[model samples]
Target: MYTALLHQYQLVMSSREAVFNYLDTLKPEDLLKPVASFNNESIGSLMIHSADTYTSWLVNFARQESRPFYTADNYKDLASIRATFEQINLIVNDFLNHFKDVLDAPLTLPKKEGMELTLSPMQLFTHVITHEFHHKGQIMNMSRQLGYTPVDTDVIRF
Candidate 1:
């Protein structure tokens, strides 16, 4: 019943893996350096934020658990960012492994200032994948601005 969504998840994660591999080749300063085009957000910060969004929507909100959030400081280099994402990938796997039965069930997603949005687990899952790619484009742009080449993270490449 969920084959298409599962395939999409695999493709997105693989693309993210390619992005991470490219990040590993960058200089430490470049990863943390703020890009004017990114509203002064460092490349590492963008990646960290995307991963945090996934965890927030999938684990914390979905499971009603308390998880610590990270900031730009947490990802000063590619290695640090990759380590954090590795952990996030595990959490994602667990989410997918157990969510088959409840994918269409309603979920209340918290928002800033005590607001919330109600949606199905499937919707939240799709949002996370798209959200990651959205920020990932910023990361790639920042990388190029910093004079670094980025790996192609297109789903077609996977």
Candidate 2:
């Protein structure tokens, strides 16, 4: 299951690279342009939010690590954003390795005082990936609103 999941994740990453490649062609200011309908979220901010979600779930919550979340200011351009994703890739790899055998084992996560959430590693992984795709759509829509046609970033490219 872990091996299959890893392969699927690889495909997702490949599609993600396509999105990043398109973003590479964008100007830093374009990436930072706030969309009024998106609650003032720029493409760069959405990207950083996705990365922060992965780190928050896999590294901080799952592994009990104190990985700090990244702000939008930390990734002003595509180069910097990609660099942060490189770190996210490493963190994801470490997480998969650590939980390879126990992907389904229930984990008790704390949420506020006197509150707890029971989830599994696979659940967390699914959540983060889906969350990324959700924001990826938003980014593409934002780019279109900013006068750029969006390239298809789906996993199954036609």
Candidate 3:
């Protein structure tokens, strides 16, 4: 279980690094350019939303010791979105670095709605990475529609 959890963490980190590299290549104007399928949402907004969702998940995980899970409020502005992305990156890195501290701990996370349920640290970690991949797909499609070259970060490519 420990080795599996470590592998999951590495996958999440690698995926994030790849996506961030893609994000870094965007020009400032590119961040705000509207994408067709996303109801004309800027690429930055999608990035921010993804990061916010992950951060909210982790924050709830850390704060509500007995709570099952929680969802984040919708992001409204660029500043908030950027901050959330930064926060998510920082928090995930911290959690990864301190895996030993909570590796064996039981987590009570929220399920579909406000319902609470128990999970292992490894399960939660896996969810975090998988969740990110799901959103990355959305962003990739949006990028292609917007005439931008999407980064290829598929696991098989690595």
Candidate 4:
């Protein structure tokens, strides 16, 4: 039952939770504070951007479902961002369930300029997760700029 993939994803979520836990320690104002070097993007916005990536790829592109992408204004606190991630969990579960049998198969999607994009379920899953980690690093760096030390947010604890 794809135990390795499932376990790896679970570890990703665990590391994500660690990030959230660290954010939880910060005051709301601090989380919302914008860092000028990152185009004034705050930690909250980066987190929301990560969630939007999950929703956009897994739900919208993969499933051909229409959903509004979240904005930084829509979620400024850990509570709301955490809630959005919970919804993302459901989307991810449905995606895995639907494509469990064909994760390696290519899924072709149409582009606006008469182009086509071909990617496998496994690729898309890897894309989103890695994308999140990329932003996770940004969030950590932003936190440091914001005068907060970051905790370990890697999939492997050691």
Candidate 5:
């Protein structure tokens, strides 16, 4: 189970890096262009939000804290989005390297009503990666809809 999970993690990381690279190929104006999504979220906003959620989960896992997910506000620019992505990527890589040792660690997370619930480290890590992938798919869809050719991110393709 551990080895399989590790492989999955590596696959996810690779896909993430590929997506980021493809995104980087876009011009600054292209990134800022609005998608037709109902949320009015631009490409940059979606990327920043994805990074924010992943980093928040990682930090919560590391600290064993009971906190709700982090939300970014006033991050309406490319610079802020890039900064958040770098920060999250750094923490994610660090966590992955030490994840085995941290597996047995206890963690707590807050509910919508402010109640705390505990989780094992493995559970936390699972949530972090899975959640990021879910949002990444959304970003990919938006990319396609916006007429930017989406990169092939399937595990088999990688």
Candidate 6:
């Protein structure tokens, strides 16, 4: 009895799994190599940032909790990132499970410059999923520039 909203949640999770599978193909050190760009964001940093963004917008903000962002020391390796992401998955799953009846519930989101935005759970989930792929491109490009070809992270096949 999966509702339309539940399907969206499943699809977003599948999309992330596809990207992480692509990440697993690279050498562990390749994660740290610098990308040949002005931004100076390495693959690891971009990935961690993407995860942190999800935690921020989806988990913390949605829960009204203020937690510090992730750091290299806290999420040093692929395993660590996956573990943290798994925790995020749990949080997201819990939210979706209990709130399935109110997927349309409006959440008050605080923004910079003293702005507040009201968005439905569906809207926030979409933002986080898209935000992830935007950074996925940076990580993919950084890996290419670092001379380590990776499996295609493009094409949301799921």
Name the top TM-score candidate.
2
Q: Write the per-residue lDDT of candidate 6 for residues 23-65, one digit (tens) a residue.
A: 7887888776666682776677787787788778766777677
Give the runs in model 5 whose Cα sits over 4 Å from its true position. 1-7, 61-83, 96-99, 102-106, 109-114
Quote model 4's TM-score. 0.94
> Would you estimate the TM-scores of all the predictions?
0.86, 0.96, 0.65, 0.94, 0.71, 0.81
Worst 10 residues of 2 by lDDT: 71-80
User: What is residue 5's positional error in candidate 4, in angstroms?
Assistant: 2.0
User: 34-138, model 1: which lDDT tens digit per residue?
Assistant: 888778988888888988998898888887788888876569777778788888878877887678788888887676699997878788788898899999888
CA shift of 41, model 6, Å: 1.1
For residue 57, what is the lDDT in candidate 2? 94
Instruction: Report how far residue 64 has shifted in candidate 4, in Å.
Output: 1.0
Q: What's the CA RMSD of model 3 in angstroms?
A: 5.1
List, residue by residue over 1-158, the lDDT tens digit for candidate 3: 55565676566667766766776676656666787678888666676656655555555564443422222332344444445656666766666555556766777666667798887555666677777788789877776776679878776563
RMSD of 4: 1.3
Off by over 4 Å in 6: 1-3, 154-158
Model 5 lDDT at residue 122: 78
lDDT of 2 by residue, 45-97 (tens): 99999999999999989988898999765678888898898988998888898
Alpha carbon deviation, residue 131, candidate 6 (Å): 0.9
Q: Pick the winner on TM-score between candidates 1 and 4.
A: 4
lDDT of 5 by residue, 53-86 (tens): 6656666546644445434542455566656666
Ranking by lDDT: 2, 4, 1, 6, 5, 3
Candidate 1 regions with alpha-carbon error over 4 angstroms: 2-4, 109-116
- Report clashes for each candidate as comma-separated counts: 0, 0, 5, 0, 0, 0
Per-model CA lDDT versus the true structure: 0.82, 0.90, 0.64, 0.87, 0.69, 0.72
